[model samples]
Structure formats: structure tokens, C-alpha cells
Target: MFGDTIAAISTAWGNSGIAIVRLSGPDAWAIAQRQVRLQTGAPLKPRFARNAVLLDEAGEVIDHILVLPFRAPHSYTGEDLVELHCHGGSLAAQRCLELLISGGARMALPGEYTRRAFENGRLDLSQAEAVGALIQARSNEALRAANRTLDGELTRAVGEIYEELTALGAEIEVGLDFPEEDVPYIADESLADRLEVVRQSLADLLERCSSGVILREGIRVAIVGRPNAGKSSLLNALLKESRAIVTAIPGTTRDVIEAVLTYRGIPLRLVDTAGITENYHDEVEAIGVERARAAMKEADVCVWVIDGSEPLHQEDVDRVHELADTPHLVVLNKADLPQQISEASLTALIPASTVISVSAAEGLRLDELKESLVGLVSGTGALDTGLNASSRQVEELRGAIASVGTGLKALGDGLDQALVSGCVGDARRSLSRILGGDRDEDLLHEIFGRFCIGK
Candidate 1:
């Protein structure tokens, strides 16, 4: 596949100031030379941009453009590469790409360029994966985490553990080779201590992976309460938009409304569900109530809104008891009005839940509420912690952890060197998979398949 030249429009298809169309492989220069006429009528120089006029197969000028060339072994994908900068618009780029394809360049597939870069040793699997993550990042925290991975933070961490395992495996091999040697290859206590250290490192990585998954996937927070308890108002206040209907009449919102907002750089899917009431005026209202309960069940955290201006109703009290085991926040809304419901009384119902007072109508203490929500979802105030892991990466790390645990147990139980070494090999392989040393074609296809065509 590397023998054939490939081309693609590397920019988004839209009217913009400029669009970039890229080509890479041995024939990249030859194919581009046929389509572009240089102003100086000179051969294209490596790493230099030159004035050019793009021509169609009919030899007519399509557009005056700029051409950049990169030499082999130093460029992205470690191949001869060319990029054409043309006037923004889908028509110009599309025409230029067609001309390049006609000149012996095949259209590149989704993530094909990045995959070529990986196959050519320009980037490791983890860093290549980060390229997609960085592009898809929804928040600054996620962007920074992906950047950290791209910078080889994850690779270095995994490499350290892998090296230790390799060393342990070598020592076991030496013991097996020289049976008559009086000095032990690796003392049982020493082996156990080393395994413990590696296991601790894996544990720390897993902890970071947990945070990364949350930052990547985000959390679902459902705002649920009885009718007229200001549930829609709170949702509007959090999202800074009137995403849900609010009215004096009960059951105005007879369905669920959802929107996404960022809190402390962590995405929060805020869902405003219909008011939960025991008695419904119609079947639709009852269905809405059921949907509200379903949203609450699916939520990572529940923001239980309560009418602070009214005394606690039996319905609200019963709902609180129902959400006793859930991670929740008791939000006493309408605090701008007289406080008829005491915080002490609310706490008495759900002792483990955090309670906050906010007037959603006035936007009072909304920032504080946001901070509390961030804390509830992620125990830390900052989302970027210098590491990030995708779901697949985390699973592999967990496998490494499990394998290390097995090795530690074998060492602790005074098992033979063969058994312990086998466990070490398993752990090493697991870590290797995370580092992209393991050649799993299905896994690579799945990871790279998420990228856009031009990447």
C-alpha cells in the first residue's frame, strides 16, 4: 500500500479562506508536477512553497495556487509529500483532487495518511490515536489530555513498566540456563518487591485512565423534581438558554429536554425531565413521569430540585427516599423567595446528599452550583492531569494489572520460576498491546476508523 501514491483534500469542505489538498508517496511529486505549473518553471524544491497555477487535464488554468513539497524520511508519513493550497470552496479543491487522481494518485481513505505515518515510524499507535482525540476534543481539558498523550507521556510510562518486566524475564531465563550456579538469579523477596512496584505503577495509570474516560465520555446529569419546582428554570440557568418550557400550569413539560454544557472543562449532558407526580391528568403525563424516572436511573448524578418557597410536600419527601442510594444533590430552588423549607429538614431526608440553595430564576449562586456539580462528577477541580486513555487503552492496562497481580501472587506463594516467568510474560504482552507493539489488525482498524477522511 505504501508503494502507491495517495491524495486527499486535507481541509473541511466549505467556503473558507484557503483549502489544502495533500498527496503522499513516491509518485506524489510526479503526479503534482503534472497538475501544477510553477511560476518560475523550475523543479519543486523540498520544504518550500512556490507560486503555481493548477491545471485541469484540458491544460486550462483552474486556479493560481501555492504548492509545498516535503522530502522523504523527514516529512509526515516519511514519504515524498506535496500539498496544494488553493482558494477556499469545494469546487476548486474537488477539481484539483480529481486532476491529481487522474495523474496517478489514488484517493486516500479515512485516516489513511495518519496510518501511513504510523506504519512508517513517524508516530506510535498511541500518538496516532491522539491525533484523532485532539481533533474530536470538545473542551480544553480534553485537548490538553490528548496533547499529553501525543507528546509521549503515555508511551514513556508504559515503556518503563515494559522494561522492568523484560529485565525480570531475562533474569528468570539466566536461572534456567545455569542450574548449577550458587547465586540465585533473582531472590524471591526481590522479585516480589519489583513486581509490587510495577503493580503500583499500573494502578496509578489506571486511576488516571478513570479520569480520562470521564473527561472523554462526559457525565449525564438529570434535573428532576415535582411540577412547579423550577426544574426547567434550573436547566435554563445551567445551559444559559431556555431549552425547556416553563409555565405556571403544571405538566407543561410533558417530556424530557436535554442539552450539553461544559463545567470546568468537563462536558455535562444536562437532562430536564418532566415533573414527577403520583397522579397524572392523562396517559401522556404518566408516560412523561415514567421517562423522568428512567432518566434519573441512567444519570451519573441527579440534581433533585425542590421548591424552597413551599413547605416539603409528601410527594417530594417520597421522591427523596426513592433516590436515597443515588449520588445526588438536593437543590433548593426559588431561594429568592421566602425560605419555607429548611436545609436541616432536607438533610434529614437524604443525609448523604449535598444540599445547595439557588434561585434559578435570578441566576443566584449558579456558579457555585456549577462548581459543586464539577466536584460531584470529578472529585478534582481540574480535568487535565497530564494523562489520558481511551476505553480500549484502559482495558489493556487493566489486563496488564491483572497479569501483574497474578505474577505477584505466584511469587508470594513461592511458585516455581517457570510459573512466575509465565505471568511476567503475560503482563509484558498486555502492556505491549497498549504501546502498539502488539499487531492486532482489528483493533487498529477500529481505532483509526473513527477519524475523518482527510486526517
Candidate 2:
């Protein structure tokens, strides 16, 4: 229904050297032609640009401009397109859009153009989503992953797996069709082999998903520990700003103070939560303590700050043990002060826990802290390992893989053909959902809604 022709301020809406009013669909060329004379003035050739004057329907001058055009099936959206590279002023872009809308073009909806591209088969769902990723990518790593997905790296991998499954399913079908041949489709010996290969591939992709997730969504690391252990001070040190209160009094931060700090170009959401304590009498402090516990549970990484100047309190010991099952660290704060705890002592308590001694008071060993935090965030360097990254996608793949295993097991047991086929079909449908094949309207809407406008 969007083919009536759409126009929008395609370029950034602001004062600049140039702003673009883009038109796409069958009306694109017609709109451009009417605004420019092909004969009297040397007009812009198709796919090229020329300086021209933009005139209203009444033949009144709007602005002098450069016009560019691309024929259908060649440009973005796989549709005829026109771009009026007019003056960069925001008002000018607005006026151009107004003129076009008056000319019978509706404003483009968010991601409408990219949606058209998907509809027209110019790009797949993954590539279309990558458009938004590329635009919002914060770090070089994130941009590379987004570009890989946009360039069809992810789609190609998915397609390969789907192809393999299709062939395997077909083989299963053949065995089912000709029971007289008595050929075992899923041999017990070969079943494990095929599954191992496929499972390993999925595991590898799932591994990359972790890095891809960090690259795409970034990681949330919550700084938690007893108050006056320099939790706020650590936040400030990492963010290189006095973003949180650092009074000597305990529980100064009675709420979550968050900062977005980049490490190795990867964005890490460092959350400074209220110190985990048991003695706070104030209701607000109690709430903060509760929040801190909640944040630690939700975080991808937790940094436990223990004051090096003070003896290890049981409260600290108790909280450390709480995160023993989670990704955590022992950060001995105030290292510049007289050491009240030894490294051997700390490590013996939190075995296998990497301890980093730092002085938030004097800003000592923060570099090591950041290094350790980044390591804990994305691992020492697993971003290189491809990760399937999307938890939704991962879950879907897992479901499909499980169904395949069930089908293979049934085949091995020479179960009824219908039962085997049913499992295979179920698995295929799961894969189809990932590829956006035969997706419901709601699913498509939800997926596309995650995309930004223009993409």
C-alpha cells in the first residue's frame, strides 16, 4: 500500500552544507522531471547529478539544487528514486518535503524504505536489520559485526545450515518412502557423527553470539560491594568523571548510578549500585541494598569492591559467596592505604576469582581494573569466535536441533514414517521462523519495529 510514492528528509535534519529530500517509487522520476527542465536547462542525466533550481507547482522558486536519480531495480529499495540535493538547512529540507507531499507524496514511515527493499527482494531480513545496526553501531567491533551481517555473512551461514538440514531431511524422507529397501536412514553410528558436526557448528555460532551480543547490545557490568569500599569511586574512575557521589560515609549511593564506558571500542554499561550492606536503618538505604542485589543478579559481570584498608567483613564475604556462581571479581580498593588484607588471603576466600588491587582513593591500578573488566565482559578475546548472539535465534535453533535429534532417533528405531516426518517438519518450521519465511503478521511487525526509520 506504500507504493503511492513516499518522500522524506532523507539526510540528517539540520543546518549543514547539504540536505536531501528523497523520493522513491514510480513517481520519483516524474517528480524530479517536473521540478527540472530537461531541455531549457541541461538536466541531470539518469544516475548523475546537475545543479538546478527547484520550483513549486506555481513555478515559484524554492531553492537552487543538485538533483540525482536512479532507475528502478538499480537503486536502494529496488525502485525508481530521486534525490534533491538541495541546501543543507533544515528549513529547506522541510520545505522540499512539504512541496513533495503537496505533490501527492506521503511522508515515509520509519524503516519504510528498507521495508520496501525487503518486500522487493533487494535484501533479506538480516540485511535489513543490519541497516539499523550499522547506523547505531558504537564501536569498530560492533560496526564490523553489523557490516558482516549486512553483507550477508550471517544469512549465508544460516542458509548453509538450512541447506544441510534440507538434504538430511530429504534423505530421511527417502528412507521412509521405500520401506522395502530396508535401508537405515539414520544409522546409529552415523547419527552421532552428523549431529556432532551440526551441533558443533551451532555451538561455535552460539559462542560468536556472545561476542556479537556484546558488539551489538554491549555488556552490562555492575559494580557491587560494601559501601565505603570505593564502588562509586570505581565508577567515577572508570568513566573518567565524577558521575557518582564518593563521600567517606557508607551507602552514599542509594540508587543505581550508570555510566557508559567504552573498552577496546566495546561499550560497557558500568552500573554503580548501592553498596550491599545489612546495617542501614533508613528505608532508602534498604531499598538501595535490595536494588544492588537485583542488579548483581542481572549483570553479565559483577565487580566486588573490598576495602584494602579494612579487615574483610563477613558482609563482604557473604556477598562474594552469593555471586560465586556468577561472573565476579574481588577488587581490593584503597590499595594506596596500608594493606589490611593480603592477596593470598583474598584469593583463598574467593578461589579462582581474579583479584585486582586498586586505589579509588589515589586512582591506582584502574588500568588493570579496566583490562580485567573487559576480559570478564567479552572474555580475553572471544569476539573473534563467531557467536550466534541473538538469544531468540539461539533458542529457536536449539528447539529445531532437538527436533532433528528426535527424528534421527526415531529413524534409528525404525519408527512409523509419519512420526519421523512430523518431527522433521517441526524442525524445518523453526528454521523458517529464523529466515522470516511464512512469518505471522505480528512477528514481522515486531521484528521490523526494532529497526530505525530510513533503514
The positional error of residue 201 in candidate 2, measured at the CA in angstroms, is 1.4
Q: lDDT tens string, model 1, 297-394?
A: 99999998999999888877777777878878889999999999887888877677788889999999999888787677677424667466787888
List residue ranges in candidate 1 displaced over 4 A: 172-184, 313-326, 409-422
Q: Pick the candidate with the highest lDDT.
A: 1
Q: After TM-score superposition, what is the CA distance of residue 140 in candidate 1 from its true location, in Å?
A: 2.7
Worst 10 residues of 1 by lDDT: 379-388
| Per-residue lDDT of candidate 2, residues 144-257 (tens digit) | 877777778777777777777677667767767765566556554565467557656655555565577677776789999888888998888888889998898887899998
Residue pairs with backbone overlap in model 2 = 111-453, 205-388, 207-387, 208-386, 208-387, 209-387, 209-388, 209-389
lDDT of 2 at 207: 58
Clashes of each: 0, 8
TM-scores for candidates 1 onward, in order: 0.91, 0.91
Superposed model 2: Cα runs more than 4 Å off: 36-44, 384-391, 401-427
